[model samples]
Target: MKQKDTGVMLLFVTTLTVIIWLWAAGQTKTEATVTTTVRFKAPEGMTSTVTPSFASVTLTLAGPRSAVNTAKAACANGLDLTVAETDGTVSINDIASRLNALDELKTSGATTVSAEPSAFNVDIQTMVQVEAAVEAVLSNVTVSGDVTVNPATVTLSIPKRIRATLPDAITVQAVVSDSALQQLSPGVVHTRDAAIRLPIPLDVPDVTVSPSRVEVTFKIQSMKEETVIPQVRIILAGPPEDYASYTVELPRKTISNVTVEGDIDIIDGIKSGEYAVFAVIRLASRDMEQLISSKPVTSFLAIGKDGAGHQLDVSVENPDALNVELNIAPVSGAE
Candidate 1:
């Protein structure tokens, strides 16, 4: 009786297994088709002159349940379409081959995997990295002081293929807003990192700029004024080697009148004697004692006082030259 019971049990178990298998087969047949969208990208080093119309492809996958599941899982991360050739257009066959080659998709038992629109055209271009200059756009502001820029240029990753041809020069303009210009008052200085923007060409779509911004610095001074200082003494810059035996004299006791023109604030400071403004004649070291007699030499005015470390833009408006006499006799054999 025990042996008979065991045989019956075995038969029951086998019949149940066959029933489950049939049910699973029916389910697979009922839901064997799965469509998924896979994102495709162009190969590296290949860029688009014009953006691609489609960034993704709809793939209809149909096969056994197991295959569909595998394909779905594999495609969940999307597809990378790398082409050895850069013809701007990808064919359906090429895509199919790539999808079939994927181990996950291949093993998934998908009978067919196809893309919608099969193929499409893209204006393709090659990319090149180059260093480009940064130009400052200063409009509606008068620059009376010094202007400086840090990192006056930037590196650009640009596309340079026909339909994607690079211009002879690639430059980005850094604009100084009107608001910024409004802040330029006398003695006012401004420093800031201004963003650089690339002007879109007639048809170019994109450009990549590294260090897209740079530090721009400038000092703004009030409008200049002309001030005349009379009887300003003229001093020789470097004296002759035989100074003890030589004498120098300006035929004119002093500049009849030295006219300086610059920012009012700076000019006032100079006039107040807060800064030392001098008329000087710079002589070449080699010609120190060579002057046998008095000679006229051009003199320029320079500031000795540190006027906020700014070079005074003052110039002598009158008497562009000053004549001076150098009386020199070499001290006994000392040339």
Candidate 2:
């Protein structure tokens, strides 16, 4: 009799165990389907590309609260976003790999599926395609019509961290420009790069640069230095018997350094016209290079602090060519 009772009890316990197992299985949630998204930007100077605007990013997300936070890490480095100009084409395969690769979101035993557009729509813009070539200009650099781009302009953002070999000095050999740097009045003008207004292309394909476009600034001293310059004098014996005075051209003028160091006597005597001082050079005609050449000059030291000839040590500077002449003037009473 006890044996029969024991069998009955064992059967009852078995039935209870089956019921409990079924209940636990029902309580466990099946892998769920969730949606998310990703975003990225296209590089500039890109004429075109074969990328989609939107993607149906279905992510197989599963977690026990722990893996839920893992979503943040999923896209950290695993998912790479590709950008395009148009809302072209996308496919399940296009993102399945990335979403599937997020092993962290996968359930231990069950499977999950990612819904379309796992996130939101991405934004893209027209990039201005550019091919950069650094050209050196001394007189003035110009963005001439030679260069062309679809956008015509770009936003040049120099990276704060970019490092490159910056040229110590840019030489502008006295040139005349009509575009911007035309102020050759012998006065100084700190030059500013018109490029400042133009953007510097960055993120070039194979080029690496730091401060790709730097501002070329220069402070021009006065047309002439403040120091006493050698002046030329023009002496003429006679013009034609009929002419009173003749005009001539002494292209180059005498220029002196502000730092003058020489014998006290020679320096002092320079102001007295003792060492063949020439103050008034005559550039009577039109000649450019001829005017720039340094030659001998003849004249008096007529230069003074107040134009009255000051007393100080002065020397012949740039004693190149001097201009002097005799011209005929009509008498007041007679023609």
Instruction: Give me the candidate number with maximum TM-score.
Output: 1
Model 2 C-alpha lDDT per residue in residues 177-280, reported as the tens digit of each score:
34544454323434444331222333333223323343434443322212354333343222243222223343332344422323344445554655443344
Candidate 2 total steric clashes:
35
Model number with the top lDDT: 1
Which sections of candidate 2 miss by over 4 Å? 1-27, 31-35, 39-78, 81-94, 103-112, 118-131, 135-186, 189-213, 218-335
- 151-241 per-residue lDDT for model 1 (tens digits): 8888876665422555667678777776766556746677866778776652244567789788888765455555777666666656545
After superposition on all C-alphas, the RMSD of every candidate to the true structure, in Å, is 13.7, 15.6
TM-score of 2: 0.28
- The C-alpha stretches of model 1 lying farther than 4 A from their native spots are 1-35, 45-50, 53-56, 87-97, 162-169, 199-203, 222-335
Looking at model 2, residue 195 earns an lDDT score of 36
